[model samples]
Target: MELSPVLLYGEAEGMVRSLQSFPLRDTGSGGWLKQHEYIEKLNMQAILNASAGQEEMIKDLLVTHGKVSSLIRELITVEIWKQKVFPVISQLQDFQPRSTFPLYMVIHHEATIINLLETILYHKDVCESAEDLVLDLIDYCHRKLTLLLSRCSAGEIAGQDRLLPSSASETSSLEELKLQAESLEFDVALKCLSVLRYITDHTDSLPLSITTRLLNTHNLPCVLVELLHSCPWSRRSKGQLQKFESGRWLSVPAEDQQKMTKLDGQVWISLYNLLLRPECQQKYNIDGFTRALISSHRDPHRSAAEPSGATAISQLFVSERTGAPKEGADLRAGSRSLGLHYQREFWEMEGDSEAPGEACVLPQ
Candidate 1:
């Protein structure tokens, strides 16, 4: 019986060779200029191959060849360039370029590297391969998520529905390129969410510094709760449920409207891992505001049969463990059990459920 080669044959060497010439820093040198395109192509190919059930080769290329850190560095470099260089280019009078496509590519670079990272970072070894730079990545994702939260809070957020301005032109100009970057922000933020979730998934293998950064330094749970409240990916449009997917918002069918999107599931699953893990629970402070936000989202009238709701989660969890009562166990005794207290309150609250047309509320 023939078997696949152990090393993915030629692809690994080519990617490694490409990395050898890839600039550690984005200095405007001839080598960097030539290698930049090659790097982008390699990243795109990695993503494409990884998605096509050929992840091992790409994973080996990233983790074995030590490309994860390089990817992170390049990602940060592009972000710095966008912040520092792009504006200067935009503001200069004599810097008229034939096409803004090159600049758009630079802005798009961060997202591309992040896409690759997201694809591979699912593996625990890939997460560990990041080493100390994982803290840098944590900080990077924090910056993006916090910027998104600040924009959302300030009402400056671009609508998911309107990815581009009404006047975006076919021709590539600085103004149009800026619009493209702004449009990409939503996608970048979503990618950040996924990266953060992957980090949470592998907290066991990650260092304390990473955990401290996530829980204490960033207070990301609160940030995520804010995200849930804002729900930038979801909207009610003309009584239709529209959700952002594959770069645009589409109407959700009635049957699937209550189902969780990938974005929502990522947030909730991260919360579950971070909150329920023994180590994480010990470290994370479950304060009053946090408790209330969680409890408030639960409605007892909801059942596990429902598509997606916190109450459904509670019901499903209880039903799984509440199978047979212990001998001489007071069924009522279970009612006030700390574990079931929240679920019971949720039921009591549902007894006086809010009136129709009531605005959905979140805890302060």
Candidate 2:
């Protein structure tokens, strides 16, 4: 006999009701059923089945795995945190993919992740597990930025692009190099700050490692300085633009060096701009840093200043640790400067103390 839709529905309903009233003293009620053993069984089955497709399953499996694993990891992380498990961040961090997805995806995810990570880090006391998540997020961002930066031409690619845009002929000139410096832009603000901070934190290595690299690498120093200068981290160079032209050497008297060594107003200003980066200020111990100045090999144009630019020629870039840069605040004003602007906004509003501007060294 054929079943009617109503009869099938009625039977299904009755069966559902019957099944729902379970604890009807079932047969399998009593053993030492290892609570989550069943759960492990199901997950293992799914993982095994998913693995059958290999890399093709990576996207889907990783998604599912990330959810489940992240959930478990998070629970453990919380427990660890509750116990003040500060040391576990490194361990938890190790679970994340050492590398990340493509640059576009990374850039897309960065801000959201950063904000989330920031919240987690802020909960250092209440939820120590959050620190691991934050550290992992930072590592992911660093890897993404590193990859993107590698794909990029260099720090001065922006300048070069502007000089020639795409013309091969444009690359051979110093003007093109200067333009390369002008065009550098960051995919992430924090990453830019991180780079600047790295330099300042490692100020002691300036003349030795950084200086040598700066002199040897094309437009990297200018690119880095420009990144810091243009942000809210410090002051920007103004007078230094006069040096951007490639042939500035011809204009200088025969004896003067190409790079300057005068710890002029701008030089100090630039140093201060570099100093304010939280990475540098927060991470570095400037006390023991010593930058041995080798004046002879250095250019006469700019001062063969100390590698640890802790000292100020003019106090313009210097800040009084607790607050922002003070106007004419013991800082000598000079036209030629070396610092980058760190303020997000281009200019100060009226009555707000103006950032004493300085000249930036343009790289042509």
Candidate 3:
């Protein structure tokens, strides 16, 4: 059912005003569950408005209420929950629930917020509205893309699992729920790729801190190189090639095997935005390792010919680094330390009580 206009405004206002951190132990609590339902509705409204080319009142309400930073915080909050808390709950001996729907909703909340931001952030105003929290959002995206790279490297991302159980019988065990969460994470990482690209689109207009964090602080160019090498979104199974598109993996025909998926385009576009910009080039230090990585992709002997996108990226990398400073401060270690700090902070907040019971049930 669609939300009425009056109810929509009330939900948007409540979501903005009630934004605060909820501990991992408080997952599925009454208050947190209420926010979950409200966000789900807002996500739907945002999508519908965008698809119909209508005025996005929900987006307006959110920006006008100054809730963009809150949304970013909530995104990171659930991300920490998924990384630190969900596994513990899944392994508890006495923590069985009647159904896994409520827990699934909690896990799905991260996707909802990122999805909403992806739709609205297309407008420059939303990016500006994100303000200083843009750094946190960048960190959140870095965590996801790095996870995607690691999974692809381990060959664990080749399987194409359904994000939700098709039948009631499938949700009976914690193992099945864990698998669903993994599949959902694959999609979430892909969405973050899109969000990062949008942020790259507005680098000139955004704060200098963003450009510094993406280039020097996080070294996303090397991360993206690894991603291009691993290519997580496509894999071969039983001698048939499959590529992930529109939330599912579909078999690709021989004629279309070489076509780049949207996922690939997102990576390529973000690379261009980061590597080709004059401001980013002056700040980015292209060391020997990064130079070699880019050069390898452009090698003619690697394949019969490189993709046009790869050609463009390598050209940009070569041209930008000419006569540029080779030595700069390496913040990779500092970034890792900061990540550890977040993990410790979240782990220390674990409540002694058991996980919350199902407060709001999701209809099948």
By lDDT, who's the top model here?
3
Q: lDDT tens digits, residues 34-63, model 1?
A: 556656666666666554455466777667
Q: Which stretches of candidate 2 lie over 4 Å from their true place?
A: 1-134, 154-364
TM-score of 2: 0.24
Give the Å error, residue 281, model 2.
Answer: 5.2
Per-residue error (Å), model 1, residue 179: 0.5
TM-score of each candidate structure, all chains considered together? 0.75, 0.24, 0.79
Find the 10 residues in a row with the least total lDDT in model 1: 355-364
Give the whole-model CA lDDT for all candidates, comma-separated: 0.65, 0.30, 0.72
lDDT of 3 by residue, 1-364 (tens): 5434434567667766766667666767998888787777788888777666668877787788777787898888888888888888788899988888888888889989999888888677789998999999999999988988877777675445774546536556677777778888888898998899879878878988999999999988778767777788888889998988878889999987866566766676567667766578678877877767765654221245523344445544564355332321122223223223322332233221322112111111
- Tally clashing residue pairs in candidate 2: 36
Number of backbone clashes in candidate 3: 0
Ten residues in a row with the worst lDDT in model 3?
Answer: 355-364
The Cα error of candidate 2 at residue 354, in Å, is 16
Best candidate according to TM-score: 3
How much does candidate 3 score in TM-score?
A: 0.79
What stretches of model 1 exceed 4 Å from their correct place?
1-8, 20-30, 157-166, 170-172, 236-239, 298-364
